[model samples]
Target: MPRIPFVIPLLLSLLGLAACSPPPTLDQQLYIWQRQWRPAHVEALAQTRLDFSTLRVLALQAHPKAGWARAYPDLQLLKRDGRPLVAVVRLDGQLPQLDPRAIGEQITSLLHDWQAAGIQLAGLEIDHDCATARLPAYAALLQDLRRQLPAELKLSITALPAWLASDQLEPLLASVDSSVLQVHAVSDPRRGLFDAEQAQHWAAEYAARSPSPFLLALPAYGVALLDSPAGAPRVEGEAPLRQGGTRRELQADPQHVASLLAELRDDPPPGLSGIIWFRLPLAGDRRAWPIDTLLAVVRGQPLRPALDLHAQQNGQLSELQLVNRGNLASALPAHIELPAQGCTAADGLGAYRVTSTPQGLRFTRQHPGQLAAGSQRALGWARCTQIDQGGLHVEL
Candidate 1:
């Protein structure tokens, strides 16, 4: 028998047509980075109450070191969704050595492939965090891409906060149909990354000087920085992120986004087309904001934090449960004390040294960790020497 070959669906992109509906007079769009191929994204889009005219999907990544491009493995387009989709190709590796011709060829090939899949694209986007000094080279690459693509295809780029200060900004913005100002990232987590006031200032300043309409890209995901005793927060390393010791460098909650939007709405920036979330929130992402939170924020509603604690007992073991019922993360209690007396270490709680405190028997997190939003964690079990109808009482 002949060996069988693996087969997967190709991405279908329809460029030059962006709006999901009959009318193209929409203002805002959503960007979806393809982390995996799951029908849940399209389902989420269909189910979401948020109003978005288009969806910008990550299609390819161009690497300068290898001088090659790689297409996303999991992304597959569906013919039925009415929303328009724009393919976004992220350029990575060394900034200066990026070959415009090579990148353009990759884009051209992707355009053909997606076109064959019957995907109607509204435009194409280039996402690159270029260095200030390398703006000229980046501009040159965009120009080449522009020439390579059809005249009807709108071109866009993702801009950085630092780029607004550079003299190259004007020329750079002039080269594309529009630019997305990413306001969510932090250069130093220890100094606090997301500042609404600072972001407002940047948006106003850039919008005033922008030659074309721009999209303000805000973060929907959270960042975890390694907290050091040396008073510096470092980026995640090769090792797995250890909970409890890490700090929430930035909290991109609905309330914060609403505040920013409210401020921006008061005096809308010049040349500001609309807002583009850094990502479309998914259920599996531990750090991504909940869909409810995203929709509420879009609708200018308030957010909340809900933390619930429950107790259960089995034989000599007593269990304490912590559940985050809200859309935002809840800080784990520094220590939890139970109402029972004469409680000693048992089960996994023994590792944390379950001991008697002044109030009662306490279990402390050996390392501090944030309980994820809409997640449940068992605080472990304590073998209390005594029990009563009063039940397990946990004091934070």
Candidate 2:
């Protein structure tokens, strides 16, 4: 007798499981774009982290919570519970010219009223792009707003990383107390994170000259869709699982994130303040990925030195080790040594065509090869560069 086919039922079973699977817990500092925040999703995420007294959920509320608290009027423009939230106004362009002083007064008064209602605020977060050039006049607005604002409330402004530059820097900087350097990876369809990284580098340059402290806003959200060709920047959300621009199912690869943190642990930049993540959400991870990887970094928690970068004894192009010794996850650029080759300092590092193996040992990275997670191999021809002395430069 012929056996019954199993594919149809199996597919239905998976669909049911997908529907029934419980949403993950939300533990990060919570914010709401309202446009994207679903009521149930909000409740699901909020309820999960609420019991953990160690964590505080701050809502960056763009749209007020619907019936947030029974005691408070819904959309009353007041605080619910006790956390401070950023009130984000949605502007889809459309304005021909904004009167700087008038607009400033209007927002300031509304914010004051919100403050009076016992609502705390980090600051007003504005989201706009190249059009934000109106910021010089807007700076005048912020100046007045800043003068009137409660001293404790900080100011914030958001700008797309792609277009931010030295010329536009001063005007935007003058407008706010802080900067959210949005690595808007999606705006560039050709290459996502490459553009994003370029944005960050340029932002860092402009930010260095500006007066405001800018938080690099890496995309916590995934790429809306993958529209580019091969060899684009690492996928938007997290590494590994989301590589090549896959969305929603993104994850912060523990190994990748861990490597980056290790470098920072090894070599920290002077005058750098602190690293802020784009969000605190359910993480939507069923496997319960290590959030502590980032938490440990944030707390200045000590981590072990797992991934070691060393010059190969072979003298050919050596593989660089991007390893994860800590229990938590981190991220790092698969660094080739400084362009100058044949340089080995007291510290074990070299420049050019370097790589590491899966066992966390140094090897050679090739022109056509890659070092992912726990593995290493050699790549390309190793020609000796002129300069040869000094330890490898690392950021811990």
Candidate 3:
């Protein structure tokens, strides 16, 4: 009979729960790195029709021990026209002699120079993989840049997963506008670069911890791992295919990334800005996915292999061509069924295993090979005693 004083408090609590809002969704963007720009790269990107709203470009990097920095100078190679750009200056090597004042001045100068050149600077991103012990120095450098940069411009940093657990992380994030959690490259490649389960766990943990909006940077490029006869892997190289020694290339499957995207979309992190790809795909880069495939995955679309079959005949000689028209790589068929028999191989298709199938001759690669997107490979030419003039009817 105390006038039911707790009733109003209970009703207010329910109201607060009802009025709470869900976390906001993050925008998806692409990173243009790990490839030299060419006409094909430009054309491939154009064909995809992806809305690359922001292009994060690697512009400059600080020299070790010296306060001076070097500009990429050939920024034109990026071909990042008609998009807001985020100029990233990477700090590499030891920073024992790092001078915050000198480094800040260099960065501020670079920003002003790019601005004068009519480049739209959405923000300046500092990519420094600083150690836990170096947090104070990193924080000081960021604070100085914050004071020096124009108020209209923003500041960001590329953060390591290990750094997320550091006590200095919160204070560091406070000094900048945003940060990028590079979820990939957490470990050595031979051990594997990305772990989907680990990524999801980190996302949930970091979302609850980060105070400012940040991005989840996923891997888009691949590395070629070469192993010796002794079974030791050599993980460093710039070329696509390494000669001498067993070489195996590793790339992230777009479909897998799509699954991760779906999980995040259902419930994204509280402070997440969006997802950013580590590198954009190039038309000539066989190790990377086609732009269309990457775009599809990002948009949560289904991916499947698309092959175009073509038949050609010249007199008694006939040819069969299988073209990969889709944006994802696929395995070659184990055998091709010919509508009629009495056909023999006229031209050997390099190294292959030719075996007899009930329907026709089965063709399998002696060595493992994949059909790359947008590429045409010869299935082999055959001389038919009785050829279908219209063309050889075949099944893949």
Please give the TM-score that candidate 2 achieves against the real structure.
0.45
lDDT of 2 by residue, 146-198 (tens): 77667877777665544443365677577677765555443544433324335
> Clashing pairs in model 3?
none
The residue-by-residue lDDT of candidate 3 on 1-396, one tens digit each, is 467678899999988986686555558777765423456656655654455567787777765655455545334433355666788888874655567777777777887777666676788888887777788778887898788888988999988778767888888888998999888866667877677778888877777777898899987666777875666676643464445766667777666777888888777767777898877666667656667677777777788777665568786677867677787777766554444367665443754455554455555656556777678788767676653333333233
Model 2, C-alpha of 326: deviation from truth (Å): 15
Give Cα distance to truth, residue 120, candidate 1, Å. Answer: 0.5
lDDT of 1: 0.71
lDDT of 3: 0.71
RMSD of each candidate relative to the true structure = 14.2, 23.4, 5.0
Poorest 10 consecutive residues of model 3 by lDDT?
Answer: 387-396
The candidate scoring highest on TM-score is 3
